[model samples]
Target: MKRLVRLATLAACLFATGTVALAQPAAAAPKTLRYSFPIAETGFDPVPISDLYSLTVVAGIFEAPLEFAFLARPVRMRPNTAAAMPEVSADFRTFTFRIKPGIYFAADPAFKGKRRELVAADYVYSVKRHYDPRGKAGRLYRLESAKILGLSELRARALKERKPFDYDAPVEGLRTLDRYTFQVKLAEPSPRFLYVFADGSLTGAVAREVVEFYGDRIGEHPVGTGPFKLGAWKRSSSIVLERNPGYREVLYDEEAPAGDERLQAVVREFKGRRLPLVDRVQISIIEEPQPRWLSFLNEEQDVAENVPAEFANVAFPNNELAPNLAKRGILMLRYPRSDVAYSYFAMENPVVGGYEPHKVALRRAIALAVDVEREIRLVRGGQAVPAQSIVGPESWGFDAAYKSEMGDYDPARAKALLDMHGYVDRDGDGWREQPDGSPLLLEYSTQPDQQSRKLTELWKKNMDAIGIRIVFKAAKWPEQLKASRAGKLMMWGVGWSAEQPDGDTFLAVGYGPNKGQSNHARFDMQAFNALYEKQAALPDGPERQAAMDAAKKLMIAYMPYKVHVHRIWTDLAQPWVSGYSRNIFVREFWKYVDIDREALARRGS
Candidate 1:
C-alpha cells in the first residue's frame, strides 16, 4: 500500500508539469524584420564615388527633401514636410515651396538637443552642395545643373577660374525669398522638373549646420530631414535605422489622381486597427546566393531582394505572391543602363596588328553564324530573355520585332562565309589562314564565374565546328571593366542595368563627349546623337515617346551589343510587410511600411 501511494504521487507530479507547460503563454516573437542583399556595402553613406552599392544602402536610412507616391493612378510629387505641394511656374523653370509651420527634427545629441525645423534656405544650401566643384556630391553632376539658371555658369566658372564650385553666387537659378518660400529658376522649361524634384536626388534636405560639421565625410555621417535617423553602420555587417518620434505621418490630397485607389483601400483596412506596424528593419548583408536563398526559405529573412536565377523557380509558387515578388525584385532600379558589350575586330585598330585581315573576316563571319537562341536557352537556362536591340527591354524604346533576322545556327553557312572571305588552309596545316597566310585565331575576354565559364566553352565549341580556333582569357570584374572601357576587347561579355526611366541613360553613354562614362562599345554616330538629344529635350509624355522610338530603331540597326537576357526581378518576403513596391528601389521599410503580426497570423489561418 505504501508503494502504491508513492506511484500515485509520481503520476500526480507528471500531470502538474504537463499542465504548467500547456498553460504558459507562448513567447511573443520579437518584432524584427530581416532583409538580405547579395553584395556588401563599402560604407553606410551613399556617395557617388562609393559606387551605387553604398549609395542605395545609405539612401534608405537618410531621407530626401521630397518624396513620391501614387495618387489617382499616377505618381504624385510632394514635399516631405509641407502643408501642400509646391507651386511651379507654367514653364516649369521656377518652383516655390512653402515650409510647414510646426514640423521639426527629433532631438539628437548631434543637434544639441534642439529640434531644428527645415527651411527654404536649407533647400538652397543642399542644391548648392551639388554644384560644389569639389566633386563632393556625385548626384549633382547628374542633375545637369546647366539646365538650372546661373547654376550652370557657376559650375563652369568654378572650373575655369579654379574656384571651388559654389552655388552661393546670387544667381537667378535658386533663392530663398523668405523663411517659408524658396524659388528655383531654370535655363529652359522642363515639364519633368517637378518629377525631378520628387525624386530623391533633389528632395533630400539637410541642415546647414550638419553640412558644415561633416563637410567631406557627410556621406558617411549623413544628416537629413526624414522620418528615420541613421542609428549605426557597421561595414560588411548591417545598417540600422531608428524611427524619429518627431516624424509627422504623411497624408496626400484626396482629389489628386496619383492617390491610388487600391493602395488607399489597403491603408484604410489597417488604419487605427494596427498602427506603427514595423518597429525596425534590419538589413543584413548576405553575399552568397545560396545562403540568401536558404535564409529566405527558413523564414530568417523577411525579404530577399535578389533571388538567384537558378533558385527562383524552385522556391516561388506560380501565384500572386510570386508575381508580386518578381515585380519587386528589381533592386536599385534604374531605367537606362550605362554599359554595353559587342564583338570587335582587333584588325580595325592597328594596336592589335597581329590579327590578320582573313582572321578578322572569319571572326565577323562567326558572329553572323552563331545561334543566339540556343545560346540563350542552353546557357542562360530560361532566367534571361534574348536581346535584339542594343537597348535592354527595361528601356523606353526597345522594340521586340527588331530581332527577327540575325541569321540562324548553320555551320555550313559559317564555313561558306569564311571560304567566301578567302580564309582557307593553304599550306595543309590544320588551322585556316587568310589569302595572305596569317593564322585564323581569336581571343575572347570573360570573367571566371560559373555562367561565364560555361558560356565561353559553348562558344568555343560552336566556333571550332566552323574551322575557327578561339582562345579564352579569364579576368576579374575590375580588369574586364578597364579593358572594355579602353576598347581592348576582341570579343567579350558584360551586363547593363539602369537607374532612371529614360532612354538617354542607354544612348547617352555611347555619345561622343560622354563615351568614357558609359559607351563601352565605342560606337558613335551623328544622326543617332541628334535623335537622342531631341528625345531628351522633349517632355515625359507621348511626344517624347515618339522621339525615343526613332532613336531605339537606329540603335537596333547598329547592333552595338547583342542582348543575352532580360530579367524581371523576383523577390520573396512574408505577407506581414506592407508599403513596399516594385516601381522604385527603396530599402527602408520603416519609412513606408506598417506591419501587423496579428494580420500575418490571420493570413496563415
Candidate 2:
C-alpha cells in the first residue's frame, strides 16, 4: 500500500509538471556531397595559383564583390558581398561599390575574440596584395595593363626600390571612400572591368590579420566570409569543407533562364531557401579514370563531375545513358565546355622557334600534320569538335560560322610545305635537317598518364611520317607548370578555359606582354598584339568581330600553337541528388546542390 501510494504521488507530480516522456525520432544524418578531382590542386591561395582545380577550391572559401546568378542563362551578374552593383562613371574609368554590413568572417585565432566585419578597406587590402612585392605572384598583368591609376606605380616602386610594398600609402586608383564604400579608377577605359570582380578566384577578399597570422602558410589557412570553411585538407590527396557557422544569411533566389526546364525545376524547388544545402563537401584527387568511375557506380561518390573518356561507351553509349545506369536512377548531363585544348611551340626554342620563313614553315607543317580528328575519335572518345580558332563557344565574338585552317589535318600538304622549305632527308638517315644542316629534333614535355602515352604515340606516328625525330620528357603537372612558366619547355600540350564571357582570355596566350605568364609559348607578334588590343577596346559589333577575325588569322599564319579541339564534358549524378547543373563560368557548385537523405536511405545509396 505504501509503494502504490508513492508511485501514484510521483505520477501525479510528473503529470502536473508535464514531464512525462514520449518517444522521439533519431536526429537526421548530416548531408554531405562527395566528389573527385581529375587532377591534383596546387593550393588554395587565389593570387599565385593558376590551375582550374585549385581555383575551384578557392571559389568555395572566398567571397567576391559580385557573383553571377546561378540560374540566370544570359548569365546575369549580381552583387554578392556588396549591397548593390557598383556605381559606374560615364567614361567607364571609375567604379564604386558598397559592401554589405554585418557580414563576418569565419571565426579564427586571428580575430582575437572580436568579430571581423567585412568593410570596404578589406577589399582595398585584398587588391593590393596582388601587387605587393613581398610575395605577390604575377597575375597582375590584367590590372597592370588596365593602368589602375597609381597601383602600377606603387608596384614598380616596390620592385625598383627593393623595399616592401607600401600598404599604408594612399593610391588614387584604389581607395576606400568610407567604411562601407570603395572606389576604383582606371587610367584607361575598361567597360568590362566589372567582370573581374565577379570572379572570386581572382578578386576575392582576404583579411590582413589572417595573412599576418598564417605568414608563409597563408595558402593552407584560408579565412573568408564565404558559405563554406575548410575543415580538413591533405595537399594533392583529399580536401574537406564544412558549413560555415558564421556565414551571413544568403537565400537562393534567382530567375531561371527561359526554356531551361532543369534550372526552372531547381529554382521552383529551392526558391527562398537558405543557400548551401549540403553540410559537407568531400573531394578526392583521382588521377586515373577507372577507379573514379567505379567509385560513382558503387555509390561511394554522389557526383561524378567528369566522366572519363575511356568509359564513355560504358557510361553513355550512342549519346544516351546506358541501360544499367538508367535503371539505377542515374542522370547524365552532357554539354560542350567553354574551353580549348591545344599544343604550343616555345617561340624561343633554338630549333623550332623563329620568325624566319623556314622556321615558320616547320611549325605550320607540323600543325598540319597532326590528326586532330583522329585524336578526337580515339583518345577523346568522340567527345569534342575540331577547334577552328582560339575563341571558345558561348563567349562574346565567337561566330559559329567562322572557319580557319587551324583544324585542317593534311599530311600531304604538310610534307609539301616541309619539302618546299629545304627540310630534306640528308646524310641518308631518313630524318630532316635544320636549315643549317644540323640534326632537327623536337622535345615535347609530357605527363606519365595513360592519356598522355596515347597522345605521345600519335605524336610519334605523325613525326615519323614527316621524317622528323621527336623525344618526350615526363614530369608531374606542378613541376611542368613551374618549368613552363619559366620558359624551360621546348613544347607542351595543354588546355585553357575562358574566365569571362568575352574571348579575350584565349588571345592572352599569344599576347607578347603575357609572356612568362599565360603566354606559355612566348609567342610575340606585333600584328597579333595590335589586333588583340583593338578588339578589346571595341564593343561587340562588326568592328570588334573584324579585329578578332584578323587576330585568329595571325595565330594560324604564325603557327605558334596547334589548336586541337573544344571538349565536351559529361557529368553523372544519382537520382537522390538535385540541382547538379554544370555552370560554365562559376566554380563553386556545391552550394546549390541538395541531397535527399530520406531517399538516399530508401534507395540504399
Candidate 3:
C-alpha cells in the first residue's frame, strides 16, 4: 500500500507540473526522394563554379534574390529573397531592391545561436566576391560588360596591391541605401541587368560571417535561406539534403500562359500547396550511363534524369512509355531543352584556329561534313533537333527561320571547300595536308565514355570522308573543362544550357572578354564584339534581334564553333513521386516535389 501510494504521488506530481501526457502512437516516417547525377558535383560554392550539375545542387541550398516562376510558361522572374522587383531608373543604368524583412539564414556556427537576418548589405558583399581576383568566377565577364560603377576600380586596386579582397569596401555600383534597400549603378544602359540577379551564381547570398568562419572551406559549408539545407556529402559518391526546419511558409504559385493544357493541369494540382513537401533528398553520382540506367530499372532511384541511349527503346518505345513501365505506373516527361551541344575550335591553336581563309575553310568544311541528323538519330535516339545556330530554342533571338552554311550537312560541299582551300591528300596517303605541305593533324578533346566514344567514331568517319586526319584526345569532363579554359585543347565537344531566357547568355560566350572563361574558343572578333555590345544595351525587339542574328552570322563566317544539336531530354519519374516537372530555367526543383509514402509502401518501392 505504501509503494502504490508513492507511485501515485509521483504521477500526481508529474501531472501537476504538466510533464505527463496521454500516450500516442509514433508519427509516420518522413518522406524521402532519391535521384542521381551523371557526374559528381564539383562543390557548393557558386562564385568559382560554372558546371550546371553543381549549380543544380547549389540552387536548392541557396536562395537567389530573384527566381524564375516554377511553372510559368515563357519563363518570368519573381522576387525570392527580395521583397519585390527592383525599381529601375537612370535610363536603365540604375536598379534598386529592398530585402524582405524577418528573413533568417539557416543556423550555422558563425551565428552563435543568434538569428542572422538577411540584409541588403549581404547581397552587396556577395556580388563583390565575384570580382575578387582569387574567386575566378567563370561568368564574371557578364558583369564586366555592365561596367558596374567603381567595382572595376576596386578590383584593379586589389589586383595591383596583391592583397586580400576588402569585402567591407563600398562601391558606388553596389551601394546599400539603407539596411533593407540596395542600389546598383551601371556605367551604361543595361536592359538585361536583371538577368545578372536572376542567375543562380550572381544573386546567391553568402553571409560575411559564414564566409569568414569557413574561410577556405566555404564550399563545404553553405548556409542559406532556401527550403533545403546540406546534410551530408561524400565527394564523387553521394550527397544528401534535409528540409530546412526554420524555412518560412511559402506556397507553390505560378502564372501559366494560356493554351497550355499540361501546365494548367499541373497548376491545378499543386497551386497554393505549402512547398518543400519532401523531407529529404538523396542524390547518387553515377557517372556511367549503364549503371545509372540499371539503378533506375531496379527501382532504387525515384527519378532518372537522362535515360541512356541504349535503353531508350526499352524505356520509351515510339515516344511512349514501355508497356511494362506503364503498368508499373512509371511516367516519362519529354521536352526540348533550352540548350545546344557543339564542338569549339580554339582560335589560338596553330592548326585549327586562325582568321586566314584556309583555316576558316577547314572549320567550315568540317562543320558541313558533320551529320548532326545521324548523331541525333543514332547517338541520341531521335531525342534532339539539329541546331541552326548557337542559340537554342526557348531563348529570345533564336530564329527558327535563320539559315547558315555552318549547320548544313553536305559532304560534297565539304570536300569541294577543302579542295578549294588547298587541303588535299598529299602523297596519296588518304589524309589531307596543309597547303604548305605541312603535316595537318587535328586533335579533338573528348570524355572517355560510351557516348563520347560513339560520337568520336562518327567524327572520324566524317573526317575520313573529307580526307582530314583527326586524332582523339580523351579526358574526363572536368579535366577537359580545365584544359579548355587554359587554352590547351585544340578542339573540344561541349554544350551550354541557357542561364536565362535571353540570347545574350549564349552570345556572351563568344565575347572577347570572356576568353579563358565561357569563351573557351577564345574567339575574339572585332565585328562580333561590336555587335554583342550593341545587343546587350537594347531591349528584346527588332533592333536587338537583328544584332543577335548578325553576331550569329559573323560566328558562322568565322566557324569558331560547329553547332550540333539541341537535345530533347526525356526524364522518368516513378509513381511514388508527385508534383514533379522539368523547369526550363530553374535547377532547384526539389522544393516543389513530394513523395507518396503510402503509395511507395504499397508498391514495395
Please, what are the lDDT tens digits per residue for candidate 1 over residues 1-605? 99999999999999999999999999976466678755555544333332345555555544455555432223345555545687878766777777776666545555777888877787777677666667434345345622777876787798899976665679787888898778877776665555445444344566767756676666667666555566777766787666555666654232323455545665565444332345566777765566777887666776666466456455553313455444543122112222333344333333222234544445446765566667655664444555554555544565556553233456786688678877777877666676567776778787666567777888788777776778999875556655665667766666555444444556654454444335555556677777766776666778777777676665444444444445446555566665444443232434445555775566435
Judging by lDDT, tell me the better candidate of 1 and 3: 3
List the lowest-lDDT window of 10 residues for candidate 3: 17-26
**Cα lDDT over the full model 3:** 0.87
Q: Give candidate 1's TM-score.
A: 0.72
Clash pairs detected, candidate 2: none
Candidate 2 vs 3: which has more TM-score = 2
RMSD of 2: 2.1
Please, what is the whole-model Cα lDDT of each candidate in the order they appear?
0.58, 0.87, 0.87
Give me the displacement of residue 103 in model 2, in angstroms. Answer: 1.0
For model 3, name the residue pairs that clash: none
Encode model 3's per-residue lDDT on 374-393: one tens digit a residue.
Answer: 99888888888888889888
Models sorted by lDDT, best on top: 2, 3, 1
CA shift of 354, model 3, Å: 1.2
Candidate 2 ranges with C-alpha deviation above 4 Å = 7-23, 136-138
